[model samples]
Target: MTYVDGFVLPVPEGKIDAYRQMAESAGKIWMEHGALQYKECVLEDAKPEMPEDAPETCKITPFGKLAGTKDGETVIFAFIVYKSREHRDEVNKKVMADPRMQEACDENNMPFDPSRMAYGGFKALVDL
Candidate 1:
């Protein structure tokens, strides 16, 4: 079965560009390390929900509107998929040890609030 690591976090208004760039780089590393896919999306049309397993989807939104979302929130969601849990763990370990991981983890420049991030690992039961 495929394994995936999913994440959601609030990205600060000021550092979106830097965070995107960093995420892009990290995504590349994950792919190179054997991730089947890596995806990131910005929350655009979200309404208050009883936070479920994950947001339904993300749509495009004006930068200003995204920045001004209730409580000044902008969600960044991502997922990395791998062939299996063991492969996911192996690649993740390498990703963590890579020097670029430190740069990617630079919270000062990261748009997302690390402390409030929601994340989990999932095993895919079906994919179509």
Candidate 2:
């Protein structure tokens, strides 16, 4: 099964371009280090509708809400794919050791709030 690193966060509208430039650079590094795929997506539709008949307890939280976006911010969902967990570890190790990656990872200077970002490694349950 494939392994993936998933991320969701809020980026201010004004910084989207800067964030994208950074992501593009980082994506290239990950790809060069053997990541199978890398993607970054921005939120478009802000409103999520729940069916009238749906139970209150059955409601789901939208990405924007979960990301805690403020008035001038939007949500970003990003992921990187790898062949397997061990493969992911190997690729990530190489990526981290890369000089360009180190330069790109100055967290204090990130375009978005690092404290608000959500990240996790996922084991694939279904893929087609």
Candidate 3:
């Protein structure tokens, strides 16, 4: 089964383009490093819900909910799929150590709060 990783973060209101550019660049890198797929989507809709990992709900809403609204808070979401957990680990190590990833450390260029970003890894239960 494939492994998956997800991320959610609040990007600054006016910096969507910058965030997109960065995400695109990094997404390509991730794919080159063995990710089966990489996707980044904007939060078009949202709802107040409590999830186990984030009990308070924060600002992220499920994709189903996000599909209906407009002008709501834009949360940047991304996912990377890997062939397996071991493959994910191997690719991740190289991705993390890549020069481009290190160059992404410029605090001034970031459009979101690094400390507040939510991220996690999951084992794929189903793909269909």
Clashes of each: 0, 0, 1
How high is the lDDT of residue 39 in model 3? 95
**Best candidate (score: TM-score):** 2
Cα deviation at 1, candidate 2, in Å, is 1.0
Give residue 67's error in model 2 in angstroms: 0.7
Q: Candidate 3: list runs displaced more than 4 Å.
A: 47-73
Q: For model 2, how does the per-residue alpha-carbon lDDT over 1-128 read when each residue is reduced to its tens digit?
A: 99999999999999999999999999999999999999999998788888899898987888888999999999999999999999999999999999998988898758998889999999999988
lDDT of candidate model 3 versus the reference: 0.78
Q: List the candidates ranked by TM-score, beginning with the highest.
A: 2, 3, 1
Candidate 2 lDDT: 0.94
User: For this target, which candidate reaches the highest lDDT against the unseen true structure?
Assistant: 2
Clashing pairs in 3: 45-66
Candidate 3 lDDT over 1-128, as tens digits, reads 88999887766657788888989888988988889999988766455566567756465647533422234336777899899889999999999999998788677777767876778899988877
TM-score for each model: 0.77, 0.91, 0.77
Question: Which 10-residue window of candidate 3 scores lowest in summed lDDT?
Answer: 64-73
Tens digits of per-residue lDDT for model 1 on 23-110? 8999999988889999988776565444466566743455334334446567787899998999999999999988888777877756
